[model samples]
Target: MPESATAAPPLQVSSETAPLRQVVVHTPGEEMALVAPGNKDELLFDDLLFVEEAREEHATLVRLFEAAIGDAGAEGGAVLQLSDLLREAFDGADARESFVEALVELLPERNFEAYEAELKALGPDALHRFALTGQAPFAVSATPLPNLLFTRDLSAVVGDHPILSLAATAARRPESAIIRTIYHHHPRFAAARERLIELPEDVTFEGGDLLVVNERVVMIGQSERTSLGGVLAVARALLDRTSVEHVLMVNLPKERYCMHLDTVFTFADDDTCVVFPPIIEEPRDHVLHIEAGAERGGDGPREFRMRPLPSVREALEEVTGRSYTFIPCGGADPIRQRREQWTDGANLFAVRPGLVVGYARNRATYEALARAGFHVVSADDFLGFYGDAAAASQDRIAVRLSGNELSRGRGGPRCMTMPLVRMRNSES
Candidate 1:
């Protein structure tokens, strides 16, 4: 008899080729309603209303992603769905049973058998609600996932490896489990041999605070969501896999607005970044860097480096081997910077080297982008360009989208987009 066939591994993304390629997204479902007006803050949400409308708007984004990738079913041009991935992982009865057992172990205090029964009883749509709201068929309290829209903050890919994130809050722990299951068992991703960087159970690491600057260097924020131990776990994991020269640990404010690194800063291009000067440039004096791997220690991990707030521009230059222009999130004005950063102004997503997607409400930020030689275009305009081969050839553009309602969810384009496969230089 022949041996059983195995699933293919997930495609590794190394560089940004076209503006955007292969993204993972989650369409809003029943779990979204768990964001009640009273407890919105607890979930890091600014406002709570219209889950259906949000789903509709998210659909537009899904369409946009499918169109940009060209062929929805192709490996390099696919939109991976969170729900679908979960369903795939839970396909086999044995897998489902094992996963439920693991989940019960993770949340030992909870009624495992009851929770498993509730999850099993739920239909496709209802499963989303049960997972998000945390309300089982029994008397369990509602624990809906109001922050699932900010998928970017849940997990991230560093170099050729993917890290299953451990969020700072207990509220988002379910999401971590969901992502871990998907990456571990999903047919497409299971083959990557991806390893999960396990942090101390109490330690937290949010994807929003972690940025993979390159294959060898990463920037992590020591903020409210990401603890020092969490950062160390990531550093050690990277070092174990390859020679990681330096892990720049940035200390950010523990305020609501400065919750994550992407909230205050994001790469606009391979050579440029958007930032809020107050946090990235003049951060409070409690920052440090740890050297890892062979060169730093004799065949072991080492940490003997510390630095004052490292300049974002300087770090980018060192990581990418190129000077970067810093575009203020809210332009040159201090007031605008604070105001816009509060609404995720700097959290722009790069589709290609010079092209990006951001909120249109941040007018000053777009103006700054224009001043820096980016051809600012609306999301509709970019989508139109994608429809027209003649216009798609144009370069150096920033696609703006109406993110008033979406931004209220506390994330911008980058938060909404989870890149799966970036085009290689040869392909581009």
Candidate 2:
């Protein structure tokens, strides 16, 4: 078949395959070494270890995903590598210059000339090391990208547009740069350049904080990483470009565990989601809905406004046009909710409508999923099913991972895997 004949797929909203059409992932790199004992907190991680072993564990994840979703170069799906995407983005003179300029703007304290020269000379592997280590060759100082392993936190897709995230913390800025470069330059996504949205100024957003429940509705978390301004930027972009009717901005505590929306909530199916009860149920907590302007040329785009919504429960029901069952993470116990939420219990990745993946360490959360009628299975089990032709037809299964060490870095399975394509519901 001709390349042009291969039409781009339609966007889906489920974690099963929305926002994330093509994801750029970095297998754990030398950057993890920067998370020293005393600097763990500063790095936004709880502990540090060898990069080689981490890479090995991460490789298992990549293999499982490839087996399940298929590789980009192969038949079923696509997986865009960060290194390849970065190289493509830096291909042209204009793009390269623009990127270097952006990098300089981000790191004004450093000597631009030396930094540029050193980065230009490095190959992909060396560049990966440089980006992770934040090491400069000459007089310039480098800033380490410690959290790149949590790829889901860097950037996200809202509808068909890719929004470049501005992390709320300084520790994650390098990740933003890498993602920006990738989206700006990758050939696989060249068609999306005109649709790219960025908040290079005061706004801050993270993929972990934004959830595209559908083309018409998005769920945003007002947490440490995503700001009010960022939400507005995303809202404006969606309103201007798509038929998004509502942006549900959920206010989360700007604390350690509740750093992003995904830490406390994720979609399980079109009409169901997992949530932390305290925020979703508390009447005092602020949750608002910003309606998108009517279709372009209709009503001249309402002045990008926001209004307080009922409750998260009600808001989701209203937007989805159906009442959803809220499966509380950490079972029904408030104590378990607090404890497991801290370890990313609510952070689950949906591979298909009813199939999700998360950290197995959250035992209470797993039980809750089971209680909710989900067939909970370990990562190994899920991988086994995928590898077996006989079990491939099964639809409802949760892929659980041994995320004790990984989750200490403030993320879970959802934070790790980025889905590219999803099987759409024929009835929808």
Candidate 3:
């Protein structure tokens, strides 16, 4: 497909646990392989990952995602690939100039003339590959976007709105640039331009830090990947444009393993959440409750009511009406908790109310989930069993994908998924 020329349907994502209908993901390619062991730290990777193996793991996610949704072409939904969107944006109608201009704006002024000259000569197909691999058949120095495969960081789709995130590091800038361009020019999403909330400069909020609880509430984390300003900005925007009434700000420990909220927390059902106990149970952490001013105002001087929360657990319930059963990331053993948290054992992407996708390597976390009444199954089993329809064990299953090699890239299922649409409960 050249592009989603059919005017893809508008996206709607309100609850984290609603059935995941459509999502965006990127397969690891040359850019991912460019991260050498010596410079891995600079690229935010703990170790070098086997790109081929990681690509295979990502394929499983796409298959599982598509199977859960039933059909790719049905209801204007599909597992939209990031590279494919980039290709369409560069190759499709009147998209070249727009995409190039957006990309150049992110680069330094001195290099703009050179990049523009080189980018124009490459044609649409080369330009698409350039966006991912940062390489070309021709000559040019480009920023290696090693972390693009972890597509969850670029932007977020919140209740009919897409918020493009600003980058925290120079290496990750291309991720945002491509995401912004695709949403603005791609025929699938350009129509939502009016509803899009563009993040301000240096706010540095990634999607992993932004978690939607329900239409009435959103929870953004103050973690390594997201700043205080980012949380506040998103919280305010959600209140202004969406049905979100309050934003719960959970402060995380400044640690690599706890880089994002999902590294330590994620919803599994309406009344359950998988979490790393230390962060959620720590007394020293902060949880701020941000609400809009007494009256409603969109373009006027907005007033924000801020207060410190006694606890994020209780405050979240107040907003979503669910006293969630907290399932520890690892089992009760502290040693296992620290071990599993390092591998993002807490980061499980909820497919629906009680079904989810997680890494199979997190044995301790798996044990915890099993105890919490989740039927753990392999991705192969889930896909084979369901074929092309919803699973019979839909509400109480966890589809575990093998991530032995992919885990080296330092993200789990939720980190790799950028959910664009999720079905709202019919009863709601």
Candidate 4:
């Protein structure tokens, strides 16, 4: 198969809540069947998932994104599947070779190097299947990648540049490698190839810990999955390349519940955020502000300045020059807050300003949004009124999705989608 002759999609994501244009997602497949009680802990799954039901739920989420963005094919604003992109990227022999080489390195214990020739020679479709399910014509079997469902943790698009992830765990290394290979070989990402940010292998970084607050500010959490070294690495790259002025380094508790920044804090609108009270609102977590220092004429190495702030809210207000409103994840009850937070109550994905999507199981969280002036509705109701432009043009909306099986993996709407392009803050 030949690559598309048309131009690639615009890859610019400056803010979390801007009108979403293009995004990437993954629907559960055979790979999910590998997740069982025996290996659920090692695979980062809290419980088992009905793969079929999870796929149906994920499909609905994709449909909602398409409806929210309207004509996705127009201006390359469609919701893309990661598997489809991997298959497309495999069109070239170089891409196939690169992927096989990386896979060999990623699974050194499996001795995939021995079958490197056979792996590279396989068809694109077969290779794509094998990449995720670890099933091939050969006798050896690698563990299926179940965590691929959380596309947000793979990589992040910061401003116009795509910052790739060097995942922290061995279970997620292949996810990072696959995304990197796609960006390196896929024609869709050709235009932004030079601007891609590659971090050192020694440092660990994941997309879930990074957030583009606005055009001028980015926030990276130093958490269990993302290291301080990784935060500094990304901060320097953004400050030097883009128009960004500040990189807020948020320090989070190294716990399973607060594994990533998005798990505790996520933007709901231009000036509002859905937060897990314990980590985001309280002073338990520290916030560090990072910025580039004055330039020294010639080709000298760049320097940076750092300062500590009281909290994440204060850091955002100081850097973005705007006040922010925080909505608790589970209304006012402390018990409800902890319960809902565990199920990803605060991990909402904003399609547009004041329009967000999250798990419906978090009833208290939805009630909180309602109290905050948001027009709360079910995913079915939201989709029923899809054709009505006026229905989507409202000031604020909270679309609840059914996540009975999907939430078993400990991720929500934001964890499932990776935005590629978004309108500028002023225009949105």
Q: How do all models score by TM-score?
A: 0.87, 0.87, 0.93, 0.95
Look at candidate 4 and tell me the lDDT of residue 368. Answer: 95
**Candidate 2, residue 294: how far the Cα is off, in Å:** 6.9
List CA RMSD, all candidates: 3.8, 3.8, 2.3, 1.9
295-371, model 2: which lDDT tens digit per residue?
55666655766678768888778777887888888888999998988888888876556767777888998888888
Q: What's the lDDT for all of these models?
A: 0.69, 0.69, 0.81, 0.87
Model 3, 243-307: lDDT tens per residue? 89989999887678898988988999977899888888665438888999865457574789998
By lDDT, the best candidate is 4
* Candidate 3 clashing pairs, residues 3+ apart or interchain: none
Which stretches of model 3 miss by more than 4 angstroms? 1-5, 71-74, 137-139, 295-299, 389-393, 425-428
| Candidates, ranked, TM-score | 4, 3, 1, 2
Best by TM-score: 4
Worst 10 residues of 1 by lDDT: 1-10
Off by over 4 Å in 4: 1-6, 72-74, 296-298, 388-392, 424-428
User: Least lDDT summed over 10 consecutive residues: which range in candidate 2?
Assistant: 11-20
How many pairs of residues collide in each model?
A: 7, 2, 0, 0
User: Global CA lDDT of candidate 2, please?
Assistant: 0.69
